[model samples]
Target: MLSALRKYLILPKLIRLSWSAPKNRTVAWDRYWAGIARTGARSDVLWDSGTDHELLAYRDVLRRHFDPSLPIVDVGCGHGAFSRALTAYSPRVLGVDVSPHAVARASGESAGVEGVSYLARDMTGPGAGAGLVGSTDANVFVRGVLHVLDAANQAALMENLRQLVGARGTVFLAETNFQGNPVEYVSHLGASLRSIPAPLELAIRKLPMPGHFGPEELARAMPKDRWTLVEDGAATIETNPLMDAAGNSRVPGYFAVLKAKDPDAGR
Candidate 1:
């Protein structure tokens, strides 16, 4: 009964948490890269729960849409394990993040790979990089990022990415799709976090739950020609690896593959 009550209390909080940025937490967006330099790109303490197949699927998409030789950007490229892993398939990969800490961590971790690099950029702001422009030259990966943003921010980010996609590139978006409990976890592949960038007040007024982008949410967010959703799948599990040792759970999330609506053109 107590557990059920706890869940019920957490539910409304999850809703606001899904859309608002953390207030007190101060992700340190400006100096986001500083810590990565100090720590030397480390594994995400929060996401120790990753898998081989998720990495493989990402690699396959890179191979499918863009050339291994061309440039690619991993937007919001957290610890960048995926970028490091991609080295097997591509010569050049770049990871972008808004947090200096995340960028530093990803860069430090991904640095050894010959063709991969890391940068820091606001998802809603300027020149993410060469790949941000799509110029028949690079592909952009916005994995596990956009869905966390509010609708307006998500739209802005996707539009910016669309510009980067140019005519012949691909954008792969893996999200915590909206099929799971906002208070518990996300879809088959991802879950919601009660702890977010936003703090208590923000939590009260805005964030109450974690989130997933609803179906058509992307389409509504982006222009028609700018993106084409190629394939989408969901993974649901009661438990799995994805949280900290002391506090993680196995929950499912959603994954999707998208290329420039015109595959031939992004090239």
Candidate 2:
């Protein structure tokens, strides 16, 4: 208990005393997600935090195009909130995250949603060389996750994802381009507590983690042969673009889904 407080509160403040803007936030996850329980004013933050409006719309668009029933697998699905949402339309969904605590919490509270399940796994997919033996009847998504890794890891993870999807599967993705929406720009705005660095933004654009492409770069990474970029999907936060003054002004991201070149490979 003392350790948790010290680490989250005291230690972070101490670090802040000498803090340079956090250049590498892959490590940032350690502290960021720790305090995300059911207490904040945005009680729904845990349940529905995506990159932005466009991305959320991407999810919805995919929901309309893809079959929610084929057992959708959401990789790095923090609290399974999206999985639960998927269940509303499709009866079977599964969420996976690297954090076991996240999985346990999601699975325990979400027990009533008969078809949805959250489980713990390395989640790195194939590049780690660990064969996660299994296949899904539907699509596999990596929303809000690619941004956290280094590019090589991202490549390995996506390659693994491709393997899981086989020749005929779909993949959904959402990530931040720190280039345009650096941390300092939007950190203190709405619900997030931590701040980021401008350098992290420029660097990711120059060298994104594994499949880490900008909105347009997404086309190069997946390639049409393995996966064709489907139109962006709909997200929970689909809102008016004109509402920019109402949004976090700085960082902008979108939700997107991809269909496999051969639709039948995953099924």
Candidate 3:
């Protein structure tokens, strides 16, 4: 009964924060990560998908843009899943997340993994990537991050990505492009009062409600004058919960490959 009441109280807060003005969401994400870590069930997170196949499906698409010699930064890399997979190609991989607890958890899980490291840094602030500026020529990989940020925060993140990639490196981002009302969307993903997927519940009850990111959003976030979009297309974002008879749970997604335009090259 107490648990039910607690959940009842959380949903309203979630709705409020979802529409609130964009600010530093480091606290919210930190809280969410801490909570998730306490659950001790890592594979059940909504975005985990519990398989490397998710990244495998995009490996070919990414191979066309990533420079194998360059270090890869997996931004918003919760638990370092993709960071580990990236080691198959890149000699060095850095998994960065806004939550320190998340970084610790990922580091703990990836203890013996060679060529992989983790950092906790918030990319949604001005001058966020100053420490990483020297990581020039480093490629970036972001999945399911942009849709959780508003335009202002998105632009800030893009600036940080620009700084990290420098001149020659590229960035690959994949974001959910869900197009439905929040209630309908959650319901379709298998949420209910009786039983909600832990990760989805955590997102709805704590983190910012997700938004959409498609071609237009990409154009706005990384304008052609400053960034070049090398490639883009439709994709599917797999989830860990709510499998159907086909044994899969997925959502509409979009992926883009981009490179920062050099200021000196044009002259």
User: Could you tell me the TM-score of candidate 1?
Assistant: 0.69
- Candidate 2, residue 239: the lDDT equals 18
Each prediction's TM-score versus the true structure: 0.69, 0.64, 0.85
The sequence of per-residue lDDT tens digits that candidate 2 reaches over residues 1-267 is 774233233334324432543454433332334434552123423214333344345645666666654556778877676667666555667787776666776786687778888776755644531233354445676666775675655655665676556554567776654443322323322212343233222222322232223555565456677676666632332212222334643344555667656544423
- Comparison by lDDT, 1 against 2, better one: 1
* Candidate whose lDDT is highest: 3
| Best-to-worst lDDT order | 3, 1, 2
Query: Per TM-score, what order, best first?
Result: 3, 1, 2
lDDT of 3 by residue, 1-267 (tens): 775344454455446545543344777778777767532224446787767777988999878889898899899998787888899879899889989988988888888999999888887767666665354568999999999889988988998788778787889999999887666566557655556566676676666667889998998898788798898999888877443323436888999999888723322
Clashing pairs in 3: none
Each candidate: RMSD: 6.1, 9.6, 5.5
Weakest 10 consecutive residues of candidate 1 by summed lDDT: 35-44
Cα lDDT listed for each candidate? 0.55, 0.51, 0.77
Backbone collision tally, model 1: 46
lDDT of 2: 0.51
- Residue 205 CA displacement from its true place in model 3, Å: 1.2
